[model samples]
Target chain A: MKKVKIYVTLRESVLDPQGSAVMGALHTMGYNEVADVRIGKYLELQVDDSERALDVIVKEMCEKLLTNTVIEDYRYDVEEAVSK
Target chain B: MKKVKIYVTLRESVLDPQGSAVMGALHTMGYNEVADVRIGKYLELQVDDSERALDVIVKEMCEKLLTNTVIEDYRYDVEEAVSK
Candidate 1:
């Protein structure tokens, strides 16, 4: 089995109000050492097989469905595992 | 300075066509042992200061702008580093 990990984040130009809030909280909580915080998402996937064609297929999926390429970006890690 | 790492990924129930494609590649690449692969996004943030109230601000930013909560989920890690 193959296990894949994907991460998504916003473009730098965009303002991150949410992160600002967290930074504010950390300061008030006495965790003043912390400077800023931004939140993203984690996606883990399991695939049936490994092949060169899969890369194209995956990229297409990301562009077409999985991600909003306009505002966010994506990356992934691949690993091998045995099926249960 | 504080650095925040955010991860964005799809829920397990969602179909990962992109991951399947990567798995196919590994198999064709002579790495037949590989089973699956999934892709996601990463977001790193640098905050101006660390404060207790920052947490709330950050969360709101993520909710309002950074991520698409419908199909994606997010999490973050916080650490302090000396500012240059």
Candidate 2:
């Protein structure tokens, strides 16, 4: 199996109100050194080995289901899965 | 400045319903090669230089705000921030 780690984040141009809220909370809690905060999604997929290229599969998955391409951008890393 | 990337994921013992839902959707969409899915949170913090240790600040933030330590675990990477 292959282990795929995907990160989906808001585009730089978009405003992240959620992030702002967290930053405010951090400041209120005395973490004044925090300048900014941005929140995103992280996904891990266990993909069974297949004839199809893993990159292509991952890209398709990101575009079709994992991400909202209009406002979000996604990137992934594929690695060999070690059995537990 | 320092760029801190934090990944917050559910502990192994917790059930991830959201991930299961995504996996089911992928199967419905014909991406059967995807065997499992796990979803988590990614946070990026732009931290200003300070006398306090970065690792110490990050750990405290994770425990107090960024993560729910009972069911979630968090890890982070700290890097020099590149001005854009």
Candidate 3:
């Protein structure tokens, strides 16, 4: 089995309203030290069978669905693990 | 100004229940190809002042609050930008 992680964020040039809301919430909670904030999403994926051809298949999936390559920057690594 | 990002995941030795639910949700949403999934929290923080000492102050914030450091693995970067 293999695992993939995807991190998604608005393009650097885009504004992040969600992040701002979070920062505001934190401030109201007494964490007034916080300033401009940007929010992003994190996702993890597990693959069923990579028996022999893992690299190619995973990369294709990442390109086609796991990520919006144009705006998100992601780093993924595959590690062998005992069956879940 | 500077920004901080914190990524928190269940320690490798612990089981992630929320993540499992999300995986199930995805499967039901027609992403049957998805398998074991893990979920984590992402946080973004903005700083107010760092007139001359940015690194030192930022590290203190990250260690004392922005992250739980005990159970989370975080990577943060600071870049200069026009004040917001």
Residue B72 displacement in candidate 3 (angstroms) = 12
- Which ten-residue region of model 1 chain A has the weakest summed lDDT? A30-39
- Runs with alpha carbons beyond 4 Å of true place in candidate 1: A50-52, B1-84
Candidate 1 lDDT, B13-64, residue by residue in tens: 7667876876675566555644445556565667656344557755765676
Residue-level lDDT of model 2, residues B1-84, one tens digit each, is 999999999999999999999999999998999998999999999999999999999999999999999999999999999988
The total number of steric clashes, by the backbone 3 Å criterion, in model 1 comes to 64
lDDT of 3 by residue, A1-84 (tens): 566665656677777787777666667655565666766666667766634466665566556665577876555666655564
Runs in model 3 with CA error above 4 Å? A48-53, A82-84, B1-3, B8-34, B48-84
Share of real contacts kept by model 2? 0.88
Each prediction's TM-score against the native? 0.53, 0.99, 0.54
Q: What lDDT is reached at residue B9 by model 2?
A: 93
Model 2 TM-score relative to the real fold: 0.99
Candidate 1 vs 2: which has more lDDT:
2
Candidate 2: Cα lDDT at A66: 94
Q: Which numbered prediction scores highest in TM-score against the true structure?
A: 2
Predicted model with the maximum DockQ: 2
- Looking only at chain A, give the TM-score of model 3 against the true structure: 0.69
Give each model's whole-structure lDDT: 0.62, 0.96, 0.63
